[model samples]
Target: MTLYRQLIIFTVVLFLLLFTGTWYAKLANTRTFLTDQLESHVQDTATSLALSVSPHVAQKDLTTVEGMINALFDRGYYQRITYTDPRGEVLIDRTLPVKVEDVPQWFVKLVPLKTPEAEADVMAGWNQGGTILVKSHPGYAYETLWNEVISMTVWFAGCAVFMLAAVGIGLKLLLKPLAAVERQADALGRGEYELQDPLPRTREFKSVAEAMNRMTVKVKEMFGEQAARAEGLQERAYHDPLTGIGNRRYFETQVGADLGEGQGRGLLILARVHALEALNTERGLQAGDELLKRVALLLQEAVSGYGDAVLSRLTGGDFGIFLPHHSSAEAEIVATEIASELGRLARERLSLSDNIANLGVAAYEGSVTLSRLLSEADLALSAAQSKGANGWELRAVSGESALPMGQQQWKESLVKALEERRVTLDAQAVIANTKERGVRQLELFARIAQEDGTALDAALFLPIAERLKLVSAIDRMVIEEALRFDFRSIGVERIAVNISPTSLEDEAFRGWLHGYLKGLPAGAPHINFEFSEFAAVQHLEMIREFAAAVRACGHGIGLDHYGRSFSKLGYLKSLRPEYVKIDRAYTGELLSGENDSGFYVASLCSVAHSIDIAVVAEGVESEEQAAVLKELNLDAMQGYFFGRPRPLSSFTAA
Candidate 1:
C-alpha cells in the first residue's frame, strides 16, 4: 500500500482500540451506578412502608392495613411487594408478571439487572407484627442502559468517520512529496533527470527529496562532463581549436553531403589572412592568433541564420565558409559581409597599413568533388588577390538551378501546390540492421509536384518554402497524406513522417496537427514524427512537450541526422526519443575499416539503447558498411543499399 493508505489504516486502528477501551469503561461504571441506585431505592421503600404499616398493625385494624397495602401496590414502581404474618403466612401480596412489557428478553438476558429485594419488620407497639418485603422493577434501568449505549455508539461512529476523513487527507498531503521523489527515481532510470520542487516540510520527506535533488544534479554534471569529453574528442578529429570551428576534415564531409543531385547549391567562400605571418614576426604569434579568431567570428556571423552553414579553419591563416542553398547574389552578400568586417578589423587594429584580407566565392550546382570545388574557390581567391588586398571575387559553375523560378514564381507555385494538394508522398524502407527482422518502418519523404510533371524533392524547395513561410502548410499536407495511407492494405504496421523544425515552433500549426491527429482512421499506421537532431538538441524542452502530445495518438517521435551538429548528446539522455538516425558521414567511413567512427557508433548506440532508443544508420551504401553497423548492434538503416525512396504506392513490404 502507499504511505498515505498505510498511515490512514494505522490511525483508524489505534482510534478503534482506544475508543473500544473508553466505551467499555464507561458502560461498566454506568451499570454499577444503576445497580446501586436500584438496591438503595428498594431498601428505602420497604423500610418506609413498614413504618407506615406499624400503626395499622398496632391497632389490629385489618381493614386499614389491607387498604394501605392495596394503595402501595397500586403504584407501578415496585415489581413485587408482600406483607407476611408473624407465623410467616402472607397477609397481602402483589407481584409482577413473568414477562415485563416494553423490555426485550435478549437485552435483559445479555445485561441482566438484579433488583435486590428488601424486608422490614412491621412492628406493633412492643412486638413484631409481620414483615414487609419490596423489590424494585428492572424495566426502567434496562431502558436507561439501552439509551446510553445507543448514544455512545452513535457518537463514537460519528467521531470515527470524521477522524478517518481528516487523517486520510492529512496522509495524502504528507506523502505527496514522496510521490514526486518516486517519479524522479523513475525518470533517472529512463536516462532522464527530473528534479523535485517545493521541498516538503516534514523532516524525513525533506531529507529524502534533498538527497534526490543532489543525485539529479550530480548525474547532470556527469553527463555534461561526458558529453564535453565526447565533443572534445570529436573536435580534435574535425575542428580547429584556436578558431573554435570545423577543421578541414569536417568541411570535406559537408561538401560531399551537399554534392548529390537535387541537393541545393552552395557557395564555398575561402578567406585568407594577408598579413598574418608579418603580424607574428612584428608583434607576436599571439597577435596573429587574435586576428585569426576575429576573422573566424566574422565568418561565423556572416552565415548565422542559415542552419546548414559551416565555418571551418583549414590552416593557420585560411578559413572557409560553406553557405548552402544560396545563389551567386546570396553568396555575394556573404562575401561583402566578410569584406566589410575584415576592413573594419584592419582599420581598427592593423593601423590601416597592413594587408587586410582576400575572399573567393565559388558556387556549385550539382555533384562535384571536394578537391575540384576547393581548387575552383582557391583559383577565385588568387584572382581576387591579383587586384590587391581586400578584394573579393565570385566563381559560379553552371548547372540546373535549385530554384530556377524567381521568388514570386516560387511562392505562386508552392501556394498552388498546397491548394491543389499537388504533392507526392514517398516511403523509404528502413531495413533491420540484421536479418532477424524484416523492414523496420516506412519513412515518408514529401515532394511538391510541379505543373510540368516534375516533383521537386524537399531539398530543392524547402529553403524557398521557408522564405515564403509555407513550409508548415507543406508539412501539414504531408502529415495528412501519410495519415490517409491505408496501412492494412499496404500490409505495414508503422509509418514515419518528417516534420519541419520551423513548423514545430509554430503554435497554430501544432494546434492543427494535434487536433487533426485525433480523426485518423482505425487502420492508420502508427505514425512516428521525426525532427532533425540539430533541431531536437536546440529545442529540447519544447520537443519533449510535443512528443508527449503526439504519443497520445499512439504515435512516436525520433531524431534524424542525429550526431551531425557536434552538439552535446546530453539531450538524448533526457528527451529519450524513440530512435536516432546517425548521419551518413560516419557510415561512409565504415567501408575503410580503419576509422574511429566505429567506436563512436558503438558509444552512441550504447547511450541511446540504454534509454530504449533504437539507432538507425542513414546512407548505408555497401554490404560491408551494413556488416560493420550490424556488428555494432545498429537497430536499423536506410539508403540505396536497402531501397531508394519511392512513391508510397510502390511500397510492397510491411
Candidate 2:
C-alpha cells in the first residue's frame, strides 16, 4: 500500500476508536445521571404526596387519597402507586400497563431504562395511616435519554467530520515530502537523475531526500565511470596508440561491417611510405618512426570533415583511409592533399630525399569482396609508383549509377518541396513490451510529395537532401510540420523525428529550433530529436552540446540506429539520451536463439540500463520477434508487427 493511504487509514481508525470510547463513556454517564435523577424525583414525589393525603387519611377519606393517586397516574407520572396499612395490608393500589411509543425496540433494548420506586410514611395527624410507595415511569426517562444521546452523537459526529478534514489536509501537507521522495525513487529506477527541487522541511523526510540525492549522485558517477572504463578498454583494442586513430583490426571490422550492410559505393585509400626500410637503415629507426607518425597525423587531418570516415594504421609504413559516402573526385582530392602534407613533412622536417609517400585511391560500386578492394588499391599504388616521384593514382569503377538526381536537381526538388510545404509526416508507433493504450513514442517519417503527386519516402530523398547541404532545411520543415500538428488530435503523448548528423553541425538550425520550441504555447507536446549512432559518434561534442540545449527547452533527445557504430558504450553516459532504438540489422538476428547477436543486445541493454537508458528493438515484424526482443529485456520496439507507417492524419482516428 502507498504510505499516504496507510497514514489516512491509520488516522481514520484511530479517530473512530477515540470517538467510540468517548461516546460510550458519555452514554454510560448520562444513563447513570438519568437513573439517579429518576430515583430522587420519585422519592420527593412520594414524600410530598404522603403529606397531602394525610389530611384525607385523618378524616378517614380513603376516596380522596385514591382520587389523588388516580389523578397522578392518569398524568403518566408514576408506573404504580400504593398505600399499605401498618399491618402490611395493601390499602389503595394503582398500576398502569406498559406502553411503548415512537422509540425503536432495538434502542430500547440497547439502552434499557428501568423504573425506580420510592417509599414514604403517610401520617394521620401524628399516627401513620399507611406507607405510600411511588414509582417513576421509564418511558419519559427513555425519551429524554434517547434525545440527549442523539443530540450528543450528532454534535460529536459534526466535530469528528471537522477534525478529520483538518487532520487530513494537515497530514497531506506534512507527508508531501514523502511523496517527493517516492517520485525520486521512481526516477532513479527510470535512470533519470532528477533531483528533489524543494527540500522537505520535515526532518525525517529531509534526511531521506538527502540520502536519496546522495545515492543518485553516486549512481550517476558510477555509471559514468563504468562507461569510461568500457570505452577505454574497447578503444585500446580497436585504436592505434601511436596515431590515436583506428588500428588494422578495427579498420577491417568497420569496413566489413559497412559493406555487409550494403554500402554500394565508397572510396578506399591506402598510402605507403616510400622505402621505409631503407630510410630506417640510413637515418636511424627513430627518424623513420617519427615520419610514420607524422604521416598518420597528416592522413587523419585530411579526413577530418568527412563524417564517419575510418583512418587507420594498417602496418608499420602503410596507412588506410575509408570514406563511406565520398565520390571518386572527393576521395582523390583528399588523397592528393595527404600526399602534399607528407611531401612538406619530409622536405621541411625529416630531410628525406625524394617523395615521402605513394598514394593509391580506389572507388568501388556494388557488393564487392574486401580482397577485391585491396587488390584494386594495390594496382592503383603500382600505377602511382610508375608515375612521377610524388605520385598518386585513382582507380575508379564506371557503369555504377549513384543517386539519379544531381546536386542541382536535388536542390531544386527539395527547395520546391519545402517551399510548397509538400512534406508530410507518416508515423509508426514504438510500443512497450507490455501492451498499453498509447505508444512509447511515435516515430514520424517524413515524406515529400513529388510532381506526379506520389509521395517519396524519406529513405529515398533524405540522403539526397543531406548531400545537397539542404538536410537542415528539410529537418526544420519537418519540425515545423510536426509542431503544427495537434498531438492531442493524433492521440499520442510523444513523437520522435530522425535528425541528420550533418544538421547537428549546423549552428543556424540549432538556433532556429531553440527559438521555434520557445515559441510553442504552454503544454505543447515536445518533439523528440533522434540521431543515428553512426552520425552521433562522428560529432560527439556537437551531439552533447545540442542535446543539452534542446532538452533544456522541454524536448527529448534519443539515439536512432544505436549499437551500429561498433564503438565503446562509454559515450552513452555523457550523451544520456532518453532512449535508444536498436538498428533493424540487429533485430533480424533475433530469430536465432542465444546467438552472438542476442548476447550483444543483452550486453547493450545491460550497459544502457545501468545508465537508465531504455533500449528499444526496431524492425520487429512478427510476434516471435517481438517475444524474443521482449525476452531480451527490451523496453520497447518499433516494427511492422504493430503496423506499417501510416499517414499522420490516420493516427488520430485510430
Candidate 3:
C-alpha cells in the first residue's frame, strides 16, 4: 500500500476510537442526570401530597384523601401513588403503566433508564397518620436520553467528514515530494538524471529530495566524463586532427570493411597537390598547412551533397575520397568540380604552383580487393599527372557484368523498378548474446532487380536515387513491402529497416509514414527505422521529430554505423535511440592486437549502457571478433558469422 493510503486509514481509525470514547461518556452522564431528576421529582411530589392529605387522614376522612390521591394520579406524572394508615394498611392506591413515545426501542434497550420511587409520612398535629408513596415514570427521561445520543452521534459524524477531507488533501500535498523522488529514481535508472524542483516543506522530505537532486547531478557529470573519454579515444585513433577528417588508417580500415566484403560498389578519388615540399620551403610550413586546410575544406564542401561520401587525409599533400553507390559518370563530375575548385585556390597566390593538384578516380564494383583498387587508383593518379597541371583521369571497371550507367539511365531504371514493384527485401538476422542464441531482429536490405536477372544492392543504386530525388519513393516502396510481409511466418515479432535521412526532410513522406504506422494492426511486427549515424547527426532535429511521431504508434528508431562520424556523443541522449550498431571498421580491428579499439569500444558501451541503450557490433565475420565483442557487453551482433543476407521467403514458419 502507498504511504498516503496508510496514513489516511490510520487517521480514520483514530477518529473512530476517539468518537466511541466521547460518545459513551456523554451517554453515561446524560443517563445519570435524568435519573437524578426523576428521583428528585418523585420525592417532592410525595412530600407535597402527604402534607395536603394529612389533615384528611387524621380526621378519618378516607373519601377526601382518596379523592386527593386520584386527582394527583390523573396527572400521569407518577407511576403509582398510595396512602397507608398508621397500622400499615393501604388507604388509597393509584397506578399507571410506563410508556415511552417518539424514541427507538433499540435506544431504550441499549440505555435502560431507571424509575425512582419515594415515600413520605402524612402528619396530623405532629403525629404520623399515614404514609404516601410515589414512583416516577422513565418515558420522558428515556426520550431525552435518546435525543442526546442522536445529537452527539450527528455531531461526531459531521466532524469526521470535515476532518477526513482536510487530512486527505493535506497528506497528498505533503507526500507529493516523495512521488517526485520516485520518478527521479526511475529516470535515473534509464540513464536520465532529473532533479526534483521546489523542495517540499516537510523537513525530512526536503532533505530526501535535496539528496536525490545532488545524486542526479553527480550521475550526469559521470556520464559526461565517460562520453568525453570515448570521443577522445575515437579522435586519436580514427580522425585527422589538422583537417578534422579521417586519417589514413581510418580510411583503409573503413574502406576495407565497407568494400572488401563484396557488398560495396563505389568510386574512389585520390588528389595530390603538385609541389607541397616546394611551397613549404618558400613560404614556411605554416602557409602550406593553411593551403592544405583550404583544400580539405573545398573537398568536404564539394561532396557534402552525397550522403555516403567519405573524405580522408591519406598522407602529406595526398587526399582520398570514397563515394559509395556512385558511378564513373558521377566520378567525372566530382573530379572536374575538385579540379575547378583547386584552380581557384591556385590563383589566390598562396605560394603554390599554377597546376595546384591532379586527381585520379577509380570506380569499383566490389569484385576487387582494397589493395588492387588502391593500385589502380595510384596508376590513374600517375596518368593524370602526366596529362598536365590540374588534369583528372577516371579508371573504371573493365568489362564487368554490372556496367556503370549514367545519371539519366540510372534514374530511369530506379523509377521503373519502383513503378513495377521489382524491389526485393533481403533479411539478415541480428542475434542477441544469450544461452538461446536469441534473434533480436531481422534487418531488411533493399535490392532492385535488373533485366539480366541480377539484383543490385541498395548501396549500388541509392546514391543515384538520392541524386535524382527519387529516394522518398524508393523508401516508401520498401516500407510498404516490409509491412505487408508475413514476418510471423518465421516467428519473428520485430524488424528493423534502414530509412534515408533525406526521406525525413520530405514532409509528405513523414506524414504518410506516421499515419501508416498508426493504422497498423495490433499483431503487426514492431518496426524500428534505422539511420546512418552521419546522416542522422546532419539532420538531427528532423529525425528526432519523426522518431517521436513513430514512437507514439509503438515504433522506434536506431542508429546504424555508429561511431563513424565525429559528432558529439551527447546527441545520443537527445535522440535516445533504441540501440546503436557500432561501425564495422572498429569491429574488424578486434584481432589486430590494438588496445585503442578495445578501450574505445568499452567506453562506448559504458556511455550507451549508462543511458539504458543497447549496443550492437556490426561486421562480425569471425568467432574471434564475436568473442571480443561479447566481452565488451554488446547486447547483440550482426554480420556473416551469424547469417548471410537471404531472401525473406527462404525462412520457413516455425
lDDT of 2 by residue, 1-654 (tens): 987778888988998899899988988898899999999999999999999899999999999999988887788868899999888999889897766566777988998876799999988888988999998888877777788878988998898889889888998898888888888888777566778867887788888889989998998787666666545644555578777777786677667655654435678988888878887888998878887778888886888777667788898878888886556767768877887776677667573667787888888755566677778898998899888766889997532333443456767888998889899988888898885624877889888998877777665577668877888989988988887878876567788988897887798987888898888898678678898886778778988898888888888789987765556676776788889888665677668453666666776777798867888887788899987888889899888889888888776645
Q: Name the lDDT value of residue 482 in candidate 1.
A: 79
Off by over 4 Å in 1: 35-137, 154-217, 257-264, 268-294, 315-320, 336-409, 428-443, 452-454, 486-496, 501-530, 533-559, 566-581, 587-654
Provide the overall lDDT of each model, using Cα atoms, as 2-decimal numbers.
Answer: 0.81, 0.79, 0.87
State every prediction's TM-score relative to the real structure: 0.74, 0.67, 0.87
Model 2 TM-score on a 0 to 1 scale = 0.67
User: Best by lDDT, which number?
Assistant: 3
> Least accurate stretch of 10 residues (summed lDDT) in model 3?
397-406
Off by over 4 Å in 2: 60-110, 119-121, 126-133, 137-184, 192-229, 282-286, 332-354, 364-369, 381-393, 399-405, 412-461, 467-530, 537-603, 612-654
As for model 3, its CA RMSD to the true structure in angstroms is 3.8
Off by over 4 Å in 3: 1-9, 38-142, 168-210, 260-264, 281-284, 398-404, 449-454, 485-491
lDDT of 1 by residue, 320-390 (tens): 88877766768877788778777777777752344578988888765556677688899999999987658
Greater-TM-score candidate between 1 and 3: 3
**Candidate 2 local lDDT, residue 470:** 83
Q: Candidate 3, residues 350-442: lDDT per residue as tens digits? A: 746778788988987756667777778889999999888788988975424556666778878888888899999999999997757788999
True-structure lDDT of candidate 2: 0.79
